[model samples]
Target: MRKTSVLIRSIFTETLELINISDVVSKSIRCDGSELIVCGRRYDLREIKHFVIVAAGKAATPMHDAVVAELERSPHVWMNVTALLISPTAPRHERANVTFFPGAHPTPNEVSREAAESTLSYLSKVDGHTFVMFLMSGGASSMLEAPIDPNISISETAEFYGALVASGLSITEMNVLRKHFSLVKGGRLAVAASRAAAQCTLIVSDVPSHSSDSVGSGPSLPDSSTVQDSISLFEGLQDRVLLPESVISFFNGPLLTETPKQTDKAFARSFHRVILSSTELAEAATRLAKASGFHVEVDSTCDEWECRDAVKYLLDRTEALARIHPRVCLISVGEVLVQVHGRSGKGGRNQHFVLSCAMELRQRHSHITVLSAGSDGIDGNSPAAGAIADWTTFERARLMGIDAQSCLDTFDSFLVFKELGDAIMTGPTGNNLRDIRILMSDHEEHAIYHEF
Candidate 1:
């Protein structure tokens, strides 16, 4: 059991290396002479005299630094180069011509609104000679904001977001509401900079790769989700806790506005590339698993699935594979939805997922190991990134007098996992590509199998 724990942790940590911010940026973007190349789209910087960079979300700081490294190494001269980074943390260090603005996450605050205000103002001033590079990742949805209705105060805006979180809706459904509520989301960010020479968006995608525009609420991409869509989703909210009346009223009132669409002029010069995503994360996990002598399979179809359903499906797949091979590893990348009930406990979707697996794996007598963790290195309200569990985890918790079901019932997987020393702690890896779940097993002595 101890060796299984060690092996899964090793695989998870190594898997995160390939998707780091520096590597993602360097591989997807570069500058040669007077040309800036990103995702194979080249911009001749000789004619474009100004360059504007806006890096936001969890990876904002490192993404900014990596892009600056490229810019600094270049000998090409520009009339002016300005950069702004909006992140959940305070500035780590100051760089010339770069301004760092601190913002909130999982919720919005005054700083978030101010950051959005500054960004809209700055981009609105850029001329046709300026080429904008928007480096976006996961947390930008809350790290940058401006409400469409001035009557909706910052508190109201934050409360609205909190309501969406507790609503148990998928991220896409939640962002539908966010896009209609914010001034900068749903392609409005690109519209504000419509006058710029050209703009390109490079995403370290936490959302599904097929819906990369959903990252950070599609700040640069055209939004297909509409205000009517938000109203419909909002109308169906089962847990409307902390939902503001003003937000609700505004959506139903005259102030409601539709998001920018494919026909919008703002997207005419816009371009995008998904630099990193679950696909990359799954590939890395597969390579590591194969090198470790396991028959590996990848299934991301469970993405955006409810946690329990996702666990059952993945575990079932692993069991079938383990029957055919001496050693098996099933790799899954993407987030599972966790719907909170009543007041929540300290845990994220990943921890909740591992705890769920422990319940199913209890008394199974199999050498199976499961790991689910965020690449960003944080999970929900807890400090631990995620956790690991195996066949022994349940009895181990029971021996320690920790009730797995009760903890899970209260959304408190973090407490049980921490007490059992199963929590994976990696502080702020400064990257976001969503979550990864690795399920693997071995046929060994004292490892007989049974099904739930």
Candidate 2:
């Protein structure tokens, strides 16, 4: 009989492989001579005079490297062709043709503001026949910002993000508000690039449904959010004093235009936005489980499912199976949101969920391995994409002088997992599928005690 814990670990491994950066990057990229294809169309670099590459989000480094490899000759690209990376560890500036800036994610910082301003400056020089390649991935919202309101600083924007995160808003909803508050978002970049030789956007989707407009707030696509929607997104947090006066003025004033109903018609003429990567990794993960000789089942749940509900469903199902056979593995995908309340701790949704699941599994000795990770290699507001936990994870914490209860109570999964050494780190995987959770049976428990 197959060990339940091994089977569960296999499932988790499969899921990670499905969304592996190499797989996603390979699938999205194709090169033929001087023509490089991103989404579908082919662009001949030889035909274009100036090539400017702009990348934002966690996937920047991979995307940048991919673009650089496609160039036939180093001289074929111009020194003016700059690369902007939102994440901290972007590609280095070895070649004069390329420039790199490390920005922030989830929240804006001084460096992010500078990067956004630099991006806008690059836009000013774009003209007809200027080849503009846009690389977008998760976390571009804050990294690609250009202040619509001059008085608003990075501090205010960061503060707003902090509050929004605490309020437990969806990425799409938060981006809707962000688009109204910035000039670079909502396809404005597309509009600018429309004046270029040809604009192509390569997106590694983090959104569950792969909505082009929602990912990175649709820098190269039409934005469907309005100011009214932004106000509503704030809800009770509207008067919380988290936002700056300039931000307040922009929100309250008439300057914040509703995002375009669709991509600018000019965008259709000048640009092509392609979704190169997404939850396909989930399918890969599914296949990996089956190939490993485990009876595998994939639940294609809607991304809109709540995290708590999803966790509950997993727990309930796992428990039921334990009651019956006690040797089943469940794999889950899609991002989950966590609403922060009072003196919260430091951890992303994946961490929080794992912490919660660990707490439940602590007493039952279910031997679960709740492995939640972002495909792009970073979870919300944290460096580690996600974490892994088994029944012993809690006990291990106790042994290490860490209290799981207090950590969860403070909503700090990062610290909890860090102490327990269960944090999953992959850097930037160049792929995104939101989060993956794998519930396993302890391998030792099945091998040593439960021989069928």
Candidate 3:
């Protein structure tokens, strides 16, 4: 049984390593010129007068690289191609036709605002013969904020965002609120691209259920939510959510076309949406489980979970898996939330979940190893994307003179995980599939103790 657990852990780790690579994933979403035929009309790229590419979110770099490579290979296609890539950081690449912009995630920065302005500037030059490609993924929301009012600053946006995270609001609800505040989100980019003769929007979906519009605030998809929905979410915010003065004024003031109504004609008229990736990482892990001779179950838990109860529910799931014959490996992929009561010290939601899970696992004789990671190679505002925890996590903390319970109480999981050298570091993976968690354990009789 111990041997089986070890094998399962190895398989899970191997699966994560394989599926998270840019090269492998790029193959799944590459745009070959041959696949360009649409609507019974074969649009020849060689005839295109202009070509433009816009890449955004965590997967922006790799996805941009892949499409750029594809276009470069098609010498038969003749056009002046220019690419605009927006991500949390600019990757190490040099292409004459490509412009890389580094922005901030989870909140808009000065750089992000500049990037947004630059995209709009480029959009103004597009013509009817231009073909625009929009590559979108998660985190695009913060990478580009439209700044509905000149008085709305990033600091004020951060305060509202901080309050929203603590309010236990769903991403869908949060984005609805975010769209009203932004100039570039909620299909506005698509509206900009509508000026082009042909527009192709490809997505590496990180949103739950692969909702195209919700991913990166649907810069290409027509907005289905309304301003009323945004107001309701804001008002329902558990007395902890703070609103910026500008946001409050915008919501309260009488402005025409403040939100996207379900019946809005803009959604149906423009843009061609394509979803290229999703929670398939769980499927990759499942294959590894089969290779290791364990029965694996992969479910879209991201869709079923409620944000408010996510942490406690995940803890319960991990505990239940720990009791599962000490041989089976349980893997899950999805996003969860950590409700911040006060100032959170430092950590992402996954780190907080793993730490909280570790506390409970320690009471059960501490045999399990839990790895919780954000697929984007980032978690919260930290460089380390995620963290790992096990039975001995608390024991190690005692050695470091850190109070595990106190840190957990303060929601400082990053600090606790850091002291134990358990944080997982994968810088700028250029992909976002939310979170992946693996739970591994073994029986006491056959378990081997590794000295640190």
Candidate 4:
């Protein structure tokens, strides 16, 4: 059992490295003296005088480093280069031309506003001789925000986010509302950059669909959502949600403007590319599982589903797969939604998912081990990445005087896993592709099967 656990952890670690930001950026973006290439689009640097780099998200620093490295290697291409990075933390590598602004995540704050203002100020200076390089990833939406209505207090915005988190809204739905209220989201940033000669956006996608318009609310791409979509989603959740009166009124009233459209002039000179996604992560895990001598099954449903239903769905699939193969490894990639009601405890969607699976495994006396974790290395409000559970997880929790069912009811899976020492902690991984789940069953092989 100990050996199996060690092998599983090793595989997960390797899977994360396969989609690291630095590697992904280095492979996708490059520059020569005459032309700068990104994801196959070429820009003539000889015609551009000034280069501006704006980056945001959890992976902002590393992504910035990668971009700067590429530009530095081709100094003849961009002689005058300036950079502005907005991230949850400071930069890992500091350079004279680069300025880093630290901001809040999962919720926007005053720092987020300052970051937006600084970016806008820099972008406002762009002219036909300038080239804009925008780097965006998962946390960009929260880290880079400037409310359209100055009257809307930051507290009101925070309250709106709090309600959305508690309401278990999908990332797509939440981003629609965010776009309607922000000055920087929904392709407005692209409009601002339109003054430049050309614009290129390199994205590390955390959203399930890998839609350029959905990732980071499409700051540098055209928005597919509209005012009507935002209003319809809000109306459906109004009764069960705790949204501010000001927010409701703002959406219900006619003071809203549509985001930039695909036909808008803003995108005429812009090129958007998704460098990394959840599908790549899942494929990497599948390859590693096969090399480790396990029959691999990959499921690519990487959307936010209800916690309980997701756990049941994975378990049923795993059980059926185990009956046919003696050594089976099921790889499921997606984010689960956990609705927090009343007084909630500390935990993220990944922790809630594994805990639910632990309870079901204990009830059925099944010998299965499951691991769920965020690719970014932070789960919800807790410091732990996520949690790991097996058939013995519930029994071990009981021995530690922790009630698994009670914890799940209050959304406190972090505490339950903490007490049992089953929490997986990787700190901030500087990457966000979504969540990865691994389920394994070896019931048929009572003896450990050797690859020899």
* Candidate with best lDDT: 1
CA lDDT of each candidate?
Answer: 0.85, 0.69, 0.69, 0.84
TM-scores for candidates 1 onward, in order: 0.95, 0.86, 0.86, 0.95
Candidates 2 and 4, the one with greater lDDT:
4
State how far residue 277 of model 1 sits from its true place (Å).
Answer: 0.9
Please say which candidate is ahead in lDDT: 3 or 4. 4
In terms of lDDT, model 2 sits at 0.69
In model 1, which range of ten residues has the least summed lDDT?
Answer: 443-452
Q: Whole-model lDDT, candidate 4?
A: 0.84
Clashing pairs in 2: 5-441, 14-285, 18-281, 21-429, 129-197, 130-197, 345-410
The CA lDDT at 306 in model 4 is 86
What candidate 4 gets wrong by more than 4 Å, as runs, is 76-78, 444-452
TM-score of 4: 0.95
Q: What lDDT is obtained when candidate 1 is compared to the true structure?
A: 0.85
Writing each residue's lDDT as its tens digit, candidate 1 over 1-452 gives 36667888999999887667787788777888778888888888777888888888998888777787778777454226788899866445576678788858889999899989989999999888889989998889999999988778998888888877777788888888888888999999999999999999988888876787799998999997877788888778834455677886887888788889989888888898887787888898899889988888898889999998998898888888888998888888888988888877899999999989988877455567899999999999899999999877777888899988899999999989999999999988888888999988877522443322
